[model samples]
Target: VKSGAGYLPVDPSYPADRVEFMLADAAPVAAISWSGRELVLPAGLPVVDIDAVDVSEFDGSVVSDADRVAPLRSSNVAYVIYTSGSTGRPKGVQVPHTTVAKLFANTESVYGFDESDVWTMFHSYAFDFSVWELWGPLLYGGTLVVVDYVTSRSPEQFLELLAAERVTVLNQTPSAFYQLAEADRLASESGRAAELSLRWVVFGGEALELRRLSDWYGRRGDFAPTLVNMYGITETTVHVSHRVLDAALVADASASVVGQAISGLQVFVLDTRLAPVPVGVAGEMYVSGVQLARGYLGQAGLTSTRFVANPFNAGEVLYRTGDVASWNSAGDLEYLGRADDQVKIRGFRIEIGEIESAVLADVSVAQTAV
Candidate 1:
């Protein structure tokens, strides 16, 4: 029977027909529901019902009749995550299972995953960041504390969850972290703050301002969590480069750099010609290696353009991150701005060109530039 790392079904409240159709399209060998829903097998595929199955209940005796054979297929379709239909319609990004595993392994290598680390899964299940936040810890047998929507929306509850869960490794957007820091909630909960086991906190989905992160850490004491500023695009899974922020680096007046590429990945600041730009000169960043996704789902044209053959490596593909960045004297990477019109606002990456193309439909302005 076909299956994946886990048998997590989509939200039960969603249309069952749509969910079934989606599962059929994805062609999973088995299905599991969070609720105790009876399984009605699809026409040809064998199915396993994991309804109400807790982590402790792994006995195969329940589904003794189910086929236990492993299915063989290309690793190119582990996650078929649909993007928000902001431009026209939602399109799925088919990421390889191998890429997902590599990204998770890379994350663990960077943060040193351990049983002592308790991660709070913040992002929606649909978001790719959730892949790292959800599976990365579980991959290493670390504890995962799922954060509810209400707690994510409220600043007070956000801090309280960290303390209550004793979250060690947390990742969030700059805006959300800023909100939690700006609020005086942590001040009143001294006991809770003292209990915080936060070892590392990562910021991504937007350019993390060092001053803002420092200010937040300063509000607490030196014993507070170490902040990690990560940078990467979705096509590369989650993160490509990350820099750990310590009290000394935070106190430095100069802008902190994004640091070198993580192990197993190669990062290059290339010019329009795709040639490596000289040190200190700004150029578009390109990432190549196992962490890169196979391609965008059903958008071969778009995929072909962004995911191109690695200029240096004969058989490799590199994801062209249209971000203008440069290397500092210390060999750290520093982001300047977007090489294209795309901007990151409130954590969502918005392509200005796409917006402008849509606005051109309206006859309001004679000339426009996004």
Candidate 2:
């Protein structure tokens, strides 16, 4: 089971022996289990052995397909992301390298990133957003400042780091951004926010209203940090589109324009028949071209259902995003809602109707809409 450092699992079958070596070599940042007494932790990490701990403490894994390598192979295993399942089992999603690269390149092009800028990583390695904040900066030759989990969780501590680090870029959820914007220190001059050299603030992992965010930042004057709203799902690398923060645009549009498709990516609003819906008509958003995941691990049926052939073109697969959206004449997209009953609350999607149906049936809640 011996292996070199940096040996991470890239696929389901990673020579069990090699993976064992990795598991053995992995230094646990924190460990939690019902049987904490029997568990051993990696060096230099505190033990928070509870019944459960958030997935943030674990290292994120990205695996790639061996045969598919060109264009970075969206099939290439990008991450071994694990999360809680409805049946109380842990489910892992296979993200791909091509997808990650697509997102990184897209953001770089959209934001005009340069080596001089410094971006802070607030999300834990387990979260998909961390991929963008970590690798995006690295690939673009920008500085990446990793903030401690404790500091990230605290409003005061987080702002202090933002100010001290002179972070030019920040990517966080809407809730996280709201907390920072509403902080007493940032709201006042005595707070170091104004003095801090932050430039662009990116928001992802949730939908954000442009007007609300603009109004909040506008109070700080015209030079306030630019806010970028990005739309994406865990399965789709990190992001598919972005909307830059412009006060005039926000005021005029009444909503943030989720910008055009990223490079090497194609977005379409399709009706039930998988036909492209007319412009300005709401339909399921389907993602094609690069940046799409290969398929769900071992779930061929589910994978086949979601990852179907592209009727528009042969030899291509398009991901059924399940998000309802419409395109304006400018080619920008406006998100309407989820095609399914799933509800995105605070940026997380759940099926509430499914939960109620399950409750009435007195069986089990297979899923719930949030």
For model 1 the local lDDT of residue 16 reads 61
Give model 1's TM-score versus the native structure: 0.79
For 96-176, candidate 2 gives per-residue lDDT tens digits of 665666776666667788898899988766566777888867887889998976897787778778887889988888888
State the lDDT of candidate 1 residue by residue for 122-181, as single tens digits.
Answer: 977756668789877878788999998888898877877888888998888888888887
Off by over 4 Å in 2: 1-75, 83-91, 184-186, 189-193, 221-224, 254-256, 351-370
Per TM-score, the best of the predicted structures is: 1
Estimate every model's Cα lDDT from 0 to 1. 0.72, 0.67
Q: Local error of candidate 2 at 106, Å?
A: 3.4
Which candidate number maximizes lDDT?
Answer: 1
Q: What local lDDT does model 2 show for residue 258?
A: 73
Model 2 poorest ten-residue lDDT run:
1-10
lDDT score for residue 157 of model 2: 78
